[model samples]
Target: MTHLPRRDIIALGLMTFALFIGAGNIIFPPIIAQQAGEQIWLAAAGFLITAVGLPVITIMALSRMQGSIENISRPLGHVTSLLFTVVCYLSVGPLFATPRTATISYEIGFSSYFGTSSSHLFIYSALYFFVVAWVSLYPNKLLDSVGHILAPLKIVLLAILGLSAVIVPRELFAPAIGHYIDHPVSEGFISGYLTMDTLGALVFGIVIVQAIQSRGVSDPKLITKYAVIASLISGVGLTLLYVSLFKLGMLSHDIAPNAVNGAVILHAYVQHVFGNLGGLLLSSLIFLACMVTAIGLTCSCAEYFSQLTKISYKLLVIVLIIFSFLISNLGLTKLITVSVPVLSTIYPPSIVIIILSFFWTFWNKPQHVVIPVTIVAFIFGVIDGFKVAGFSKLLPDFIQHLPLSEQNLAWLIPSFSALIICIIIDRYND
Candidate 1:
C-alpha cells in the first residue's frame, strides 16, 4: 500500500470534517439534548454511533468498492445499480437534501431576524439562492477557500456557545414526557439517526475519494487507509461538538419552557452568556455557516449533473437555487415534519447497502447477495414510510386491519425477515 504524505493526510481530514459539520450539526443535537434533558449524554452517545461511526464505515466501503456511486451498487446488476444510483443521488441532491439546505439556512439564519410575511421570507430566500447560484456558476477553488474560512468560524462559535453554558451557571429541568419514556437509550439511538449527517458523510465520501484520486493516489488499498483515518479525525471532532451542544441544551431547560424550539434555546443561551450583542454575533456566524453550506451543496449537485447530462452547470444551479428558495418558505417545522417520512424510507436502504457491501467478499456471488436483499429491504422500508406518514389508511380496510397495522413497525418486521432469508440462502448456496 502506498502511503499518503502526513501533510496531505491532515488536509484531507480537515476537508472531511468540513463536509460533515453543517447547519444540522449545529441545530439538531441541542434540540435533542434539551428535550432529552437528563438523558442528553445517552442520546449523544447514540447519535455519535450512527452520526460518526456509520459515516466512517461509508468511507471505508467506498474506498473498498473503488468506484462511483453507480459502481458501488454494481454488485446488484446494471438495472438495479442504475435505479439505486438515481434514487441515492436524487435523495442527496436536488430531490431531498439539497432543498433542505436552503430551508435550514432560512430557518436558522433568517427566520428569527426576518418578519413573519411569507412574501418577504420568499424574497430574502430568493436573494439567498441567487447568491448561491452566482457563486456556483464557475467552479473555482472556492470550496477550499470557503471551507477553510468557515470551518474555523463554526468551531469558534460552537466553542463560545459551549463555554457560555459552562461558565454562566444554568439549572437543568425535568426531562420531557416522551423524552426518556420506554427506552431512553434506544430512543436516543434512533433519534440520533435523524441527524442525517451520516448520510451526508456517505455522499461526501465520494467527493473525498475523488479528491484523493485527483492527487494521483490510484491504489485502492492506500485510498482506503487514508479515508479511514481522515474520517476518524472528522468523527472525533463531530462527537466532541455534539456532546458540548447536548450539554448546552440540557442546561438551557431551566431558562425556558419545554416548547421552546432549538433556535430559541440557542439564542437564549447566547444572550445569557454574551448578552444581546453576543446573541446577534452568534446569529451572524451561524448565518454565514449556513450560507456556505448551502452554496457548497448547490455547487456539488449542479456540477455532478452537468457532468452527467452536458447541461450548463450555471443554468442548473440557478434552477436549483430558485426551486430551493421557494421551498424554503415552507418554514422549519413543516419542513422537518414533511422530510421525516421520506428520509425514513430512503436512508435505511442506503445504510443497509453500505453495511452489506463491507461483507461482499463473503458471498459466493456478491450480486446474488446484494440485489434481492436490497430490494426486499426497500419494499419494507417504503411501507414503513407510508405508515409513518399516515398513508396506510389509503389501503383497503381489510389490508389496513392486518396485524402489521397494529404494530406500526412495517420495515422492522420485513427487513429482519429478509435478512434471515438472505443469510439462509447465502449459506445454503455457498
Candidate 2:
C-alpha cells in the first residue's frame, strides 16, 4: 500500500481547508460576531458546531462510503438517491455556489478597481472561469496543482488577515441585538448553517478522496484514514479563521455601527486599520480564497456529471465553465436572493442524511428508517425555503408555531419523529 508522505498529507489537508473557505464562509463569521457582540463567544460556539463541526462530520461520513454522495445515500434507494445527489451537485455547482464564487470574488476583490458594471462582471467571470476550466480539466494533477500550490498561497493570505484581526486596534464590543440578545447559540447556529459549508463538504468529499488517490494511495483503509485526517485539519483551520473573523467583527462596532452586512463591516475595518494597503490585502485574500474554492467545485462538478451523463470529461468542463460564467453575470444580489431559499430547502435533508448515515447499521431495516426520515426532512425543508423566499403567509398558521420553526429548524423534530417511528416498525416487523 502506498502511503502519502507527511508533507503530502499536510498539503492535502490545506487543500481541503481552502475548498471550504469560500466567500460566504469568510463573510459570515464577522457579521455573526457583530450581532452576537458581548455574547460573541457563546454564539461562536454554536457557529463552529454547524460551520466547522457538521462539515467535518460530513467528510467522515463520506470517507467510509468512499466519498461518493451516491454511496452514502444508498439507503434512500436508487432513484431517490440519484435525485438527492444531483440536487446536491447542482446546488453547490453551476446553479448557485460556483457562480456566486465569481460574483463575490469580483465584488470584493475587483469591483472597486474595475467598476461593477455588467460588462465588467462579465469580463471578470470570463477570465475567472477560464482559469477554473484549465485546472479542472486535469483532475489527475489536482493534488500537486491545488493541494500543493493554490492551497498554500490561500493559507498565507488568510494568515495575514487573521493576524491583522488580532493585532489591530478597534472599538469596544457592541451589545447583542435581535435574537442574539437572548438566543445567541441558536441564532449563531442558524447563521453558521446558512454558510452552506456542509453542502459544500458533500460535493468536495469526492475531490478530497481523489486527491489522496492521486498520491498513489489506493488502499481503501488508508484512503478513509487520510480523508478523516484531512477533515480534522480543515476543521481546525476553519475554527481558527472563524474565531479571528468574529473578533474582528466584535471590535468593528464603532467604525461600522450601521453596517448592513459582513461585507460592509469588513470593508470599513480593513480600510480603517490597514490604510491604503488594506484594499490590496483584502482583494488578494478574497481572490485566492474564492479561486481555490472555485477550482475545487468546478473539478468536482465536471467529474460527477461526466460520469453520470457519459459525456466526455473535457466537454463537461467546458460546458460547466460557460454555464457558471453566464449565471455569475446575474450579479451577487440576485444570485443570493434566489439561492437562499433553495439552500434552505436542501440543508435540512442534507443534514438529516449525513447525520443518520452512521446509525443505519443499528436498524434492522436501515432503508425503512433512513428513507422516511429523509423524506420528512425534505418536506419541512421546502417549507423553510418558502418562508425564506418571503412566502410565509402562504403557509398555514400552525407552521409558525412548530418547535424551532422560527429558527428555520422545523424539520428537526419531525425528522427525529419519523426516525423513531421507523425504527420501531423496523424492530417489530423484523
Candidate 3:
C-alpha cells in the first residue's frame, strides 16, 4: 500500500482549501461581523459552526465513504438515491451555485464599472463562464491548476488585503445591531446557512475523492485519511480568512455604515484603503476566487452527470457550462431569490441525511431509521419552502408553532420526533 508523499498530501490539502474558499465565502464573514459589532466573536463562532464545521464534517464523512455521495444514500432506496443525487447536483450545480459564481464575479469585477444591470452584464458573464469552461475542460490538471497556481494567487491577494486592513484600519469597533445584540450566536448559526458551504460539501466530496485518486493514493483508508486532513486544512484556512475579514468588518462601520451587504462592505473597505488601484486589485482577487470555484463545481457536476448518463464528461462540461451561461443571464439577485426556497426545501433533508449517514452504522435495520425520517424531513422541508415564499397560509398554524419556528428552525422538533419514532419501529421490527 503506497501512501501519498508529504508534498502530494499538502498539495491536495491546499487544493481542497482553495476549492472550498470561493468568493461567496469571502463575502459573508465581514458583513456578519459588521452587524455583530463588538459581539463579532460569538457571532462569528456560531457562523463557523455551520460554515466551517458542517463542511468539515461533510468532507470527513464523505472520505469515509470513499467520496461517493450516492453510496451514502444507497441504503435509502434506488428512487431515493437517484432523486436526491439529481436534485443535489442540479440545484447546486447549474441551477444555483454555479451560475451565481459568474454573476458574483461580474458584480465584483465589473459591476461598478458597467453597472449591475448594464447590457454588459451578459457580456461579462459570458466571458466569465467561457474561462470557467476552458479551465474545467481538463479535469486532470486540477491539482496543479487549482492547487498550485490559483490557490496561491488567491491567498496572496487576500493576505495583502488583510495586512492592509491591519495597517490602515476602518474604525476601532462597530456596535452590534438588531438580533446580533441579543442572540448573536443563534442568528449567526442561522446566517451561516447563507454561505451554502454545507450543501456544496455533498457535491464536493466526490470531487475530492477523484482528486485524491488521481494522486495515486489507491488505499481506501489512506484516501479517507487524506481527505479528512484536507478538509481540516480547508476549514483552518477559511477560519483564518474569515477572522481577518470579520476584523475588518468590525472596524468598517465608522467608514461605511450604510453598507447593505457583504459585497458592499468588501468593496467599500478595499476602495477606501487602496483607492482605484486597490479596487482593481480587489477585482482581480474576486475574479480569481470565483473562477476557481466555478471550475471545480463545473468539473464535479459534469463528472457526476457523465457517470449517470452515457454521455462523456467533456461533452457534459460543454452542455452544463452553456446551461449555466444561460442561467447566469437571470442575474444574481433573481438567482438568489429562486435559490432560497429551493435551498430551504432541500437543505433540511440534506442535513438529516448527513446526520443519518454518520450514525446509521450503530442502528439496527438502519433503513428503518433513515427512510422514514428522511421522508418526513423532506415533506416538512417542502412545506417550509412554501411558507418562505408567502404560501404559509397553506400550512397548519401548528407547524408554525414548532419549537424554534420563529428562528426558522421549525424542522428540528418534528425531525427529531420522527427519528426517535423510527428508531423504535426499527427495534420493534428487529
Candidate topping TM-score: 2
The digit string of per-residue lDDT tens for model 1 on 182-246 reads 45565666666666765665556566676566567888888878888877887877777777777
CA-only RMSD, every prediction: 3.4, 1.1, 1.8
- Local distance difference test, per candidate? 0.68, 0.90, 0.84
User: Residue 380 in model 3: shift from native, Å?
Assistant: 2.8
What is the model-wide C-alpha lDDT for candidate 2? 0.90
* Candidate 2 error regions (>4 Å): 169-171
Candidate 3 has an lDDT of 0.84
Q: How would you encode candidate 2's per-residue C-alpha lDDT over 1-430 as one tens digit per residue?
A: 9999999899989999999998788888888888888989999998899999999999999999888999999999999899999999999999999999999999988899999899999988999889989899999899889888999988998888888888876647778899999999989999999999999999999999989888788999999999999999999999889988988897778888857888888888889878899889889889888988888888889889888999998999899889999899999999999999999999998998999889988888888888888899999999999999999999999998999998898898999989889888999998
2 against 3, candidate with superior lDDT: 2
Model 1, 364: alpha-carbon shift in Å? 0.3
lDDT-wise, the better of 1 and 3 is: 3
Per-model tally of clashing residue pairs: 0, 0, 1
**Of the candidates numbered 1 and 3, which has the greater TM-score value?**
3
